[model samples]
Target: MGSKLGAAVAAVVLALPLLVGAGVAGIGSALFGGSGTSSLNCTPDGTTTGTVPGMTAEQMINAATIVAVGKQMGVPEPGWVVAIAAALQESKLRNLHYGDRDSLGLFQQRPSMGWGSPQQITTPTYAATKFFEHLTATPNWQTMSVNDAAQTVQGSGFPHAYAQHEDKARAVVAAVSGVRCQPTMAGTGDCNNIQAPNPAAMTAINYACGQRGLPYVWGGNGPLNGDAGFDCSGLTKAAYDAAGISLPRTAHTQYNAGPRVPDGSLLPGDLVFYGPPSKIRHVGLYLGNGKMLNAPTFGQPVQIDNYRYPGDDYAGATRPAEHHR
Candidate 1:
């Protein structure tokens, strides 16, 4: 049953891009502190970049385990990149046999901080989750900054250093994630599952997409709920309501409600989240192939893209009530 569920999810992923054009996406691809590829064009940063050096491939493989863990834990690619970059800055992704003094494993987690046994920290996924789980609890973490989000968790000596690796992290995410993520066509039901939308969510996603060129309003959801402009999550949420689905008013709440999607099986209409892993603060509806129809901010209108927030803090996906219908 579990394998069928997994395959069903996989089928939905494979058909999604075709369905959306269709598009959707995410995947974790590194562990705490690993060096990034640093050779691709991507969105610039408003955050810290982490990169040190001396990461062995063995350590790199460990970081890869985090990618799988992040996807499973609902951490987005952006979060994955940030976590990886921070780890790179901290331990060079080596999953160090030891830390600054007694700090052991990747990111030099301290035994004093309750990081776990040395072997656990050495396990790539264990280390990454420890980092992410800690990040999720930082105070004011949501609004602080990306590297800052990491800093709150890892508590490294360097907060500014993480930014240097942002581009590299972005590159890694692009290089590794795309190859793995394959959104399915929602409602197909075989391993080819393409679950139908409940009506309101589909309407919500389409309505915003339909108003492709409208101005983005701070709190507007059209003059009558589906016409004019919309705030970030508001635009997508209203459309979902139109489709007959009920969703919590905020992105964080959305994360709390659904079955966490694994990274490799993304699909259209999947709720993509952004912001701190510890605190989900934003969301968008996935379209497919590689695009998302969203009500971007103040100056932007609902536009299509391969991911959310130029791909920042993507905390993974969830199915809204309508999506399961």
Candidate 2:
């Protein structure tokens, strides 16, 4: 995603030694490509735009748009960092009418290459979403270095360019999203300061959290049925079951059996359901700060991810603790 405009600067910078190693390859892929298995130590601490230095108002707005799009798409803060860094390297965070060859917009995607029509590629929201779609498709992209991740998506001639912007990208993401993310040794970042779960709901939350990294199996229940993995509803059902509450076997049935919580009032331990009301396809245990613990899909593990994403069919949430109370 590095723009030709930034390539010259990147070449000069790449002459200096870089401290970051190559991102690990061959890890199993997830919906967004990172291992959400580990807990993040970051929190939505509050936005601080002044902390990001030397950007014009337009640039800042574009940067915020990128972050906002990432959030809307249920991308994690790390993904936001990659998107911002890619944007910074590509067009310096400016939505432009032109780039190298047919390239256009923030990431310099090209209409001729099927990134989109010229109009769609130039639009900030459309551009960011397209970038994330490619990014999340890259295997182990979440663990890739900024340069590597961006290059994987952009196929840039200047492959090393994006790394130079990583620090600034992290800063931009924090400034815009109010979430401070610290990269972990495992090549993932942890978020902290999530609101505490209701005391009565802790057992369920703890049970679900403890099952991170288990495989996702269709109609499978963890251990209770001698299966090593869990499907979405199976995880939630087992989690609540550990808390002395019984839940129905399937996602739709589970939603029907609810003491439903309203939107914007989701507490930790709420069972967040997705898909239409008549055909809820997935469920996750809410873990606050927009994260949820669930068995996402085949090949993905039980892990934490943003509960909401662009075009995700989010049904609603239910409080099993309240139901039993």
Candidate 3:
């Protein structure tokens, strides 16, 4: 699992898109609804009940493609839920043209990672078909939770993230296919149930907490750089660096630098970022208890502060893998 996840990380550099980033634009008729590549009897008379409210037309179109592809492939309804959940986590139901490394399309699958060519993956039908192919190939995917099934194919660092979108995935699938599925899938429940970080993650956070009294420097030296104090990204950079992980320099880049962690499923050593996905400016290491350790601006010393300070931008959080970058 670790080796596959490491390979996934190395292969898909910016593959982890922001969970709440600005929506991608300009999906025409081809990718939307069904492309009619294969015959499926899932033509909806109208928008089904339980469709996700506030979903963009692009999201609905991608959802339709996912369901259509699954049906044409003879994948079960549960498989539809798994596919929807994985797409939700990977590309937010958009057939994107760009992703980390060579990743492209709805699942952010990388040609370099052996999924398919850029042309094939960028097409909604092709992308969803490829995803279902890998998914059904997994043993007992029907019995697995959405997360387990998705993680088996995605190999994302945050394997538990797929479960977080189960309800919405179920809704999206139900809406598109007109098959109402219960929110809970077979494998597991909410990812927030994961209470404690593993020992390695604990070690990384503790190392950062130990540096609480260090002074804040703009681009000052981190422990990795062997400097006196830390900057925002530098603090997290130093902590994960101690854990033998390499991270990007800025807050925005660092946001997409590692595995995509859902909002409430954050672990101890996770890096939290501020601002919307389009404009991530600040960052910190979560210390639990609604507090994070960060270096705030020039002249402010490194210390523990409220995770959400008044007027804080509050973007999202990401967790680094336990292995070397």
The lDDT leader among the candidates is: 2
Task: State in Å the error of residue 142, model 1.
Answer: 4.8
- Model 3, range 117-215, lDDT digits (tens) per residue? 787678676677678777877988878778899999899978899999999888777656642211110111112221123334444565676776788
Alpha carbon lDDT of each predicted model: 0.55, 0.70, 0.65
Can you write out model 1's per-residue Cα lDDT over 1-325, one digit (the tens) per residue? 1233233322332322111110111112221011211111112233211111443434344444445445544566667777777777787666678657788776788767777666656655457667767665565665666677777777667668887877665554443342243223433211122222223334455555566777888767675755467766676677677766676766677777776778855655677888786788767777654556677677887777657445376888887733432
The stretch of ten residues in a row with the least summed lDDT in candidate 1 is 18-27
lDDT of 3 at 262: 64
Q: Supply the TM-score for candidate 3.
A: 0.43
Comparing 1 and 2 on lDDT, the stronger one: 2
Better of 1 and 3 by lDDT: 3
Quickly count the clashes in candidate 2.
10
Each candidate structure's TM-score, on Cα atoms with residue i matched to residue i, is 0.40, 0.47, 0.43
Q: What is the C-alpha RMSD of each candidate to the true structure, in Å?
A: 16.9, 17.0, 18.7
Model 3 misplaced stretches (Cα beyond 4 Å): 1-42, 45-47, 179-325
